[model samples]
Target: METVTISPKYQVVIPKSVRRQLRLVPGQKVQVIAFGDRIEFIPLKPARELRGMLRGLDTTFEREREDRA
Candidate 1:
């Protein structure tokens, strides 16, 4: 658990340790969400970087007789 103080401009600096762990670089955009009372920050990645991320998964499944074409 970490504590951070919000600056007068309503900005808070993410801690170095957390930043290093999350590989957060400067100028990276993050999606901020307000969940109930606490806020969350999710790092955004380019669609190109996410390509082929789910390769080789078990996709086979049993199909109903009427649904099969």
Candidate 2:
């Protein structure tokens, strides 16, 4: 396991290997989620990456609406 030190300003540097593995870049947003006793850091996707993820969801939602009606 890699070790990191938190700076006095509450900032910690993610190691180079970990950053490369996670595909993290400078100024990228990260989400810190609390899971039980540990925290998970998830990288936020850029808006372009989220554009078409809902393509099938729209049809599913319409089908559900029609079923309810």
Say which candidate scores most in lDDT.
1
lDDT measured at residue 36 in model 2 versus the true structure, 0 to 100: 100
| Residue-level lDDT tens digits of model 2 in 1-69 | 788887999888899999999889999999999999987889999899889887866443345555765
Every model's TM-score: 0.79, 0.65
- Predicted structure 2: lDDT: 0.86
* CA lDDT of every candidate: 0.94, 0.86
- For model 2 the TM-score comes to 0.65
TM-score (C-alpha) between model 1 and the true structure: 0.79
In terms of TM-score, which candidate is strongest? 1
Q: Where does model 2 exceed 4 Å of error?
A: 51-67
